[model samples]
Target: MTKIAVLGAGSWGTALANTAAENGHDVRLWTHNLNQVEEINQQHTNSKYLPHATLVDTLVATNDMFLAIENVEIVLSVVPTKAVREVAKKLATALEEQAHTVILAHATKGLEQGSYKRISEMIAEEVPEAYRSALVVISGPSHAEDVIKHDLTAVSIGSSDESAAKLLQKALSNETFRAYTNHDLLGSELFAALKNIVAIASGALIGLGYGVNAQAALLTRSLVEMRDLGAAMGAKPETLYELAGIGDLIVTGMSPNSRNYRAGLGLGKGKSLQQVTEEMGMVIEGVNTTKAVYDFSKMYHVDMPITSAVYQVLYENKPLRTAVADLMARPLKSED
Candidate 1:
């Protein structure tokens, strides 16, 4: 059995740890909170994140980062975007002291602020060269809630190194969970981050009383925006149409379980951004991603009206109805 270390006690981390343990791997789950560590080890439950789910008995938890990463073959970084760099630096130090290199994989989705680097890129930048092996990105339409239920879920693993992608695919694939490998890491990461922005807009539309017809149209246009931006950044055009792209957009935009969608719904219903974030009690990745994409679009000169509209509503205090009107009032143009 392979040794696996999962950094973060969030729903996604816990679920992944459970999956690995069920597959008979030696799994170590790490969290900063000692209480969470106790809960996972003693009760096999992470009540704060996965309220209804019970983790596998063999999956262990630790509050110490060194203990978690000790002698592990794989390290799965599942922390938030804001915390990625710090965790990567720590992991690098830990791995530097180890005798062997470990495979690095991250499931966190979102672009870093200021630098605006993707999660995988940020990890590579922070991790020391000797401690790291092939870096891979694991992302798709699957949600933590569904994954814990052992719902049939499919996700894509992207890496420039084909063997790395294949290794992770073998490690994660099971009867209930499927993993597909792809070479277009850029396209997969871009689509994964940008789709959350569209989901927020989708939730806003639903809150504004727009019907399925409107939602469908908005999603189609959003796909175009995603493709345009990804292509300009050197991603393959067809990759944006794959499971990591359009498939993720559809699921995130339409599902109530999506935090970004729920946050947008709050905004559309006249609540402030602060109110939405406070009520959800979880990181609304789309909120920050909207700002990052807005800045990136300005820098890259990409045309993204819907993303800009969401940005205005979220950041500029533009009334939700006014943002909708602005979007509808755009000069007529042929569909490209």
Candidate 2:
């Protein structure tokens, strides 16, 4: 069995660790909270995140970063986007001190706020050169709640290194879960980050009592927006049509399990962003991603009307209906 270290104790992190353990790997899940570590080790549950689910018996938990990274063959970082740099820096330091090498993979999705770097890029910047060559991105439509239920799920692992991608695919795939490999790291990462923005827009439509026609229109247009932006950012156009792109968009945009969608639902119902965040008690990635993508669109000169609408509603205090009207009122253009 492989030894894997999963950094982060959030819902996604715990779910991934459980999956690895179920695959017969020796898994160590790290969290900042000692209480959570105890809970995972003793009770085999992370009550705060996955309250109703029981973790695998083989899964262990630790608060010590060094202990978690010391001898692992692979490190899967599932922390929120904002925490990526900090956790990666710590992992780099631990790896340096131990003089060990392992494959680096991340399931975290979102761009850095100020720099707009993808999560994988942030890790490559922080980690040493030895580990950078094996970096992989594990992302797709799978949600933590459904994953723990052993529901059928498929996700993509993107890496420049074919062997690294296949290794991760082998480590994670099972009867109920499947993994596919792709070489378009940039496209996969960008799609994963940008899809959250579209999900927020989709949720806003539902919360505003819009009909299915409106939801369908928003999703179709948002897919185009995502494809255009990704292409401008050096990603393959076809990647936007893959699972990491359109597939993720459908699940996050339509499913109630998406935190970003839930946040948008609150906003659509007239609640403030702060209220939605407080009520959900989780990071609404799309809220921050909307801000980032808005800035990126301006910087890249990409036309993203839906992302702009979501950003206006969230940050500019533009009324929801007004934003929708603005989107619909844009000058007529070809659908190409």
lDDT of each structure?
Answer: 0.88, 0.89
lDDT of 2 by residue, 128-165 (tens): 88755498998899999999999999999999999989
Q: How accurate is candidate 1 locally (lDDT)?
A: 0.88
Question: How well is each residue in 240-312 modelled by candidate 1, as lDDT tens digits?
Answer: 7777888788889999889998988887787889988999998888888899999888988999999999899
Q: After superposition, how far is residue 111 of candidate 2 from its true place, in Å?
A: 0.6
**Candidate 2 RMSD to the correct structure:** 1.0
TM-score of 2: 0.98
Question: How many residue pairs clash in all the candidates, one count each?
Answer: 0, 0
The TM-score measured for candidate 1 stands at 0.97
TM-scores of the models, in the given order?
0.97, 0.98
